[model samples]
Target chain A: MIIEGKQRIWADYQKEIADDHYFYVRSCIRQNFFPASEVTFWKIIRDYVHKDIFENEHHSSCSGIGYHSDVVPFTTTQAVVARQFALMTENGYKNLTSSCITSFGVYSEVLETWKNFPEELERTRDILYKATKREFEVPENVAHTSDLIFKYRNQINDMAKYRLVNVKTGEPLNGVEHIGCHYAKMFPSKGVGGAEHPYVLAGMIESWGGRVVDYPERRACCGFGFRQYFVQANRGYSVACTKRKFESMEPYKPDFILTNCPGCPYFLDRWQYVIAEMEGKTYGENGYGIPVLTYEELAGLVLGIDPWDLGLQMHQVSVEPLLDKMGISYDPVKKYLGVDNKNIGQPTCPSVLKV
Target chain B: MGKLYDMLKKDVRYQEALKACINCGTCSAICPAASFYCYDPLEIMEIVQSQNETQLEELLKSDKIWYCGECLSCSTRCPRGNTPGLLIMALRKLSQDTGLFVESEKGRQQLALKRAIGDNIVRTGYCIYIDTMKPERHPESGPVYEWIYNNRDEVMKRMGANYKGDGPGPMRNIPQETLDEIKKIFDLSGGTELFENIEKYSEQKAKEMGLQFDETTDCEYFNEIFTKTTKKHTL
Candidate 1:
């Protein structure tokens, strides 16, 4: 529990993250759940940070879900990811950044697998060539999109219109930063601040004027276990995982939960509503569950992006309370409206949780 | 070494994941699955280390092998650098390979995964498409998700996504050519074969269990595996 000891280890895990021109890949689930988060990322990087980021419409899902769920073979995952590297090589980019933490882990695993087993790497090359007639040189750098955001946190803060602070109280808001296990747990050296005390999200929390909540379950997974959630009956395990984290963090009274993983934020956000419905429990103040946000959405808010435009409305648990706490304004009427400004209709509220 | 051990030894994940086990409970202590389910990664490792064919075979056929969330939390804290999570991956693969996965309730769900995620990849180029995420299948997502599913086009348009349309953006309709390429990669890389194995074994198990099997998702066997749970899964 030595703070200085953790700091030293965190410093040791710092990677030489690239600053520009990364070939990007999208998550299969992230876009479906938080559609605008990636769009918000483009706006922040290309529009705000003034950096070069490229994506291929041809590149598809990294097959991490299939691979981890044990349907896709490791060789298949390697070849599929090799095709991604081929797309990058053809498009002439050397850096790779994926929006999903699972894809980040897949990439890290593939890279490590290749380094240890050149025959598998050769087989992957042959498979990619035979299938797509494409040749690939592995990217010079690999990073999660959040790592890129963390690298430019100071620049984002430099242009901040709002911060993670209670404007009324003038005290920094407490945020629980949860890292995806795949981000570093499997391969510690691949991540920003390693596995145990990851600083990727924590760095953003600190730089954006928020205090990090060191809850007992801070390092615990958000429990969007692919098969666990994908299969209906096993959902209890998934919800229970979220419940454990929420119970552990409740005593801290954190203002919000922040995450880098596609699944983490989705589960952390949606499960609160589910938990309240099932058990009549709520983690946040006064029947409102704690607001969970992706790193991009948090950045979008700090950059004065409209709450509705950032797609905070997609989240099951409402972000309104946290927005209000930060003194960020939004037209509550516009929350459920379409681009045509017509009411799209609202979801039925849960019994115990506010939406 | 026995048959099961021989097969496990061939898997790169098995080779990389299990180095040495001192029967340390660190992996089990850190495992989220272990906390909820009656699972012990330390015991799983110890059994694997014993090289006993009967124990390993029993493990492959049991619900215990399927309990891991694959979070790889067990991969991080092993004093011997033994990644029990990766070992679980290897054991699960062997389970599927030998048609033993259908013996347990959780293991039979492999067919559901093969159809949902595995088929989705070959068909849609994305492992999950919005059209497939029906609220009935995913009740945990709740009423908001149902609304979003119903009004997805407008919602996606507002979010600036292409929403199954062409060109680069989230949830955009992946091109047919790209889908073909992905299918080909799977074909050459043993994914299609693995998928076939899951189907072949699942269908066989369904017949043995006297459940209806069909090509589509709506079948007695799919329903059973997708919905079946035992109280033993939880504390």
Candidate 2:
């Protein structure tokens, strides 16, 4: 739903042709906390995918996090949507792609409701147009990166040339894929499959030669949005959800866990460590712990990209066990410094190229 | 008219709190926490609704009760709008009051942290404070001299006397009276003894179970021990 970073990569690979024009909506959380992930995603798209894809930076966050928490007013949300739509039109990239699931869910809901109710849209449009000297119509094309990635699964699979061999346990590395809540629940029809059992990310993992483990809390939220961990420490609720996933996947003894959304990774990575502490437990056959990884990072590893090049070590949870499981020697400092110039084996465009 | 049930009825803001179920199994069907273990939210809700103290006591004593992750998916998707998540919290509070499940090493350890937080909050309007922020040799390891030496500023900050101390403020608002009340409650709930016996009891139990106990106060080592132990138990 929120089409940021890894989701965008999935979309580009799925769509095959790089999208030149994009309504590059921003997220407050990502902008402040994970600016690099956002910037890197766009750079990858611009450098490797179609350079013609429209990129606009005028949109603000959807304010869904605040809105859902009952902190922000509904009027504020409507205003945000109105302004975002206007920005999309102004940038000549009416097609919108959300990097954050919450933003995608909010934008889609607002646009869908607006299209069905002219009076509501007109009232909001009047306020926005008067303020910005521009008008907007909810564009026909609006989707999360997941939608685009799922559409071109075969192409991505074909392009993936390398295979990651697990050095530990003498077995190939397996993963548990976490498709974020917004991507699945916000638009059921547009989703890859049943929202409860979405398999887009899992399918991709399988194609990439990794096994996808079915976890009990596979579909549950990572509890990041609730801020349950910080607000209500040691309540057992936040970690319980995480524990369910760990236990469910424990049977398979996954080498690493993959998630598309950054928020999920943040919570899963950090909270898994906390849960282990609270419960007084270790994971894996040899007390190895599970590492939360982004889909791109996992793909990069499988593609033989250096760990630091993929930013694998930046995660709060240690990826040492995962690297050991995959039998890859990782140098955190070097991996962090190395950049993927080839951008997942996609072609880079020269400045002379036209959109 | 137990305090737990009364609190749930009066304080829980969700609309589903009012819905009465006929011992239906639907909530359990979708409960993620229930999927792995034997605990069932529907069953827990039934016990609470019944107001049967015996059933409630039996439910509270089991390790299954602590498995809830509080995802609220059950609350959101319940056909009858019953929130097992809230019910579980109420049950945990009751369990703490009864001292039924506090004997377990993990439970005792939690009580220790809770007491530490409570005592520190009462004393300085904050949680635990040390001379430095660096990991020290755990108390069992005899006064982590190296950690104390290396991280004096961090320890001072944690002590609540420093400018950057994570003591109570405008937001966390841990008043002295509240801290005293919490400490009193902890004593009544046998939390003091639980906290005292954690390291001793956990080491013995972990050894019995063929687990290692590295009781280093070095925050990092304790963290590693805690994680390793919990992962083994959970998996």
Alpha carbon lDDT of residue A76, candidate 2?
41
Cα lDDT computed for each candidate against the true fold: 0.91, 0.51
RMSD of each: 1.9, 15.5
Candidate 1, A223: how far from true, in Å? 1.5
In model 2, the Cα lDDT at residue A278 comes to 53
> How would you encode candidate 2's per-residue C-alpha lDDT over A1-355 as one tens digit per residue?
5668757645533322224466666544343223344444544445434344454323334546543432233344565566667767777765776666667666765665566555657766665555455577676577665444444445555655444446545555677788776664544444555465566677767776677777666777665433233223332445566666677777777777777664677667655555555564655555435787765556555545565545443454567767665666666434222133212121122122110
Clashing pairs in 1: none
TM-score of each: 0.98, 0.55
For model 1, the stretches where C-alpha displacement exceeds 4 angstroms are A1-11
Docking class of 2: incorrect
Q: So what's the TM-score on candidate 1?
A: 0.98
